[model samples]
Target: MAAAPGLAPDAPLHIVSNAGSGSKDAHEARQQIEAILTAAHRPHEFILIDNPGELARVAKQAAEAAVRSDGAVVVAGGDGTINAVVQAVLPTERPFGIIPQGTFNYSSRAHGIPLDTREAANALLTARPKPVQVGMVNDRAFLVNASLGLYPELLQDREAYKRQYGRRRTVAMWAGLKTLLREHRQLIVEVEHEQGSETLFTPSIFVGNNALQLEQVGLEEAEDVKRHRLAAVIVEPVSTTELVWLGIRGMLGRLGDDERIRDFPFRSMTVRLLSSGKKRTIKVAVDGEIFWCEQPLTFHVAEHPLSLLTPTTVK
Candidate 1:
C-alpha cells in the first residue's frame, strides 16, 4: 500500500458543494454545512459552482488556490459531483474531504463516511485520510463498480415513478417490477482479462473494484490495498426463472453458492459489446449515476488514498 498523504495541523480547508441536486429539501444543505463548520471553529472557505460543467473548472481553481495557500478542500455534493472533482484533480496531491449530498452516496458508503451530511461535516475534524482502495475504468475514477443490467432500467423507471408518486419505496418497487416484465432480453458480454478470457450471456455484468460496503457488506477497519485484489461477477441467467431465482439468492447472500455469480477474479477486466446484428449500446451506472456508453469498458484497481473525514472507524 502507498503511504497516506500527510495532513498539517493548520492546513487551510475549503468546502466545495452544489446547493441543489437530490431531494428538494436539500436546497439549504450547503448553507447548513457552512454554518456547522463555522460553529465547529474550523478555519475554512466555501466555494459554490453555480452551474454545470463548472465543477471541474472550479475544482481546478480551488486546488490551485489551496496549493498557493497550502490548504485542503472538503466537497459537499452528490456522487457525480464528487466523481467530477476526483477526475479533475487526478495525480495531484489535492486530497478530497467529502460531504455526501446525493440520493445514494456510494463513494461515502464505500469509505465508511457518515451518511448524514451534517454529521459527516463534523466528523472531518477528527478523521484523517486513510490509505484506501480506488477503481479506475479507462482512466475514469469510480469508487464502486461500473454496472450494466436491470440496475440501470430500475433507475430509469424509479425516476419516472418518483415524478408520479413522490419518493415512496413501494412505488419505486412497483416501477422496477413493471420494467423487468417489459425488458427480458439477454446481454452477451465478451470479457478479456490479464490471464484468460470468456463469454457470458446474461442480463448484465457488474465489474466491481470495491465491494459495496453498505447494506450488503459491512466496512472493514483496515483495508490493505496491497493484500486485496479486484473481483468481478458476471450474471448468466438463461431463462426468466433462472434470473429471478439467482437474483433472489444473490440478494439473500446465497450468491457464493450460486453458479451464475461465480466467475474468475482478475486484477483487471475489459467488457466488450458482443451483440450481433444491432448497434450494441447499454446504459451504464457508476455509483448510482447513469450514463449511456458503447462497448469495452475497462475495470481495474488503482491504488490511491482519498483524504476524507469520518467520525470513527468501522470494520
Candidate 2:
C-alpha cells in the first residue's frame, strides 16, 4: 500500500473514451455520463478515440492534460483500452478512473466498481484515488493478466472471428475451438521463476494478476493472487480431445483438480524464447490486445501501484 492521491472537490475530469470498443451503445452511454456530470456541475472533457491506433496517443494526451489541470484521467472502454491509459498515467502519477464497458471487466470488478458504464460514471464523481497493484510485462501494464504462446494466437483468432461473425462471447468461444482443433505449434521456453527453471513443452503459459478472473476460470492459483503473488497456469501438451475436455472442465469449475495443467505461484518470472532460436520476437496478449515483444519477457508486480479512483477502499 501507498499514500492515496488527493482529489479536489471540484476537479475536472479528462476522460479517454473509445466510442466503439464494446457492444454497448457508446452514444447513449456518453450522453448519460455527460448528464450526470452536467447535473453535478462538474467540468469534464471526453477525448474520443477515433481508431485503435490512436488509443496510446489519446491516453497520453488525456493523462498529461489531467496532470496539468489537477484533475483525473478516466477511461471508458474495455480492459485493453484501460491498459493503454494505465501505461500513460502510471509514469505521470495522475489519478485514474474507469467506466467499465467490456465483458468480464476484470479490473473494475476486482475493484468493486459498477459494471454498468453509466453507473460507474456517476460513481466517478465521488470516488477517491487509491494505490492498487498492477501486473507489468516488458514495461507494459496489464491490470488482470498477460499471456503468450497459444493463448495469444487464440486472442488473435478471436479478433479475426469477431470481424467476421460479429462481437459475441459465443463467437469467441467458437473461434477458440477452431484454433484449438487446427494444427498448433508447441512453445519451447526456458522459464525462470522463484522455484526453479525448466524448459517446458506447453501450448500456453497464462499469468494471472487478478483473483476474480483466475477463480472464474476455476484455477486454484486464485488463492496465490490473494497472498500477493502472481498465479501462473501452464498448459502441457495433450491430444486435441483431451484439450477440449480440459476446456470443458475449466468451464465447469473443475480445472483446479485437472492433472493436465500445472499451476504455480511466483513473485516474478522471466521467459526466454527457445523454439524460435535466433528470432526473439513473439506475440503477447496483454489484457485483450496482442502485440509483438522481443524476449526475454519479465512478468512482475509494477514498481509503483497505479493511482486508481475507486468508489470504495480497494481490497
Among these predictions, the greatest lDDT belongs to 2
Q: How does each model score on lDDT? A: 0.66, 0.86
> Of the candidates shown, which would achieve the greatest TM-score relative to the real structure?
2
Off by over 4 Å in 2: 19-24, 313-315
Candidate 1 runs further than 4 Å off: 20-24, 51-53, 163-175, 213-227, 276-282, 293-295, 312-315
TM-score of each: 0.81, 0.94
lDDT of 2: 0.86
Question: Model 2: how far is 98 from its true place, Å?
Answer: 0.9
lDDT of 1 by residue, 197-223 (tens): 878777877655555632242222113
Flag clash pairs in model 1: none
Backbone clash count, each prediction separately: 0, 0
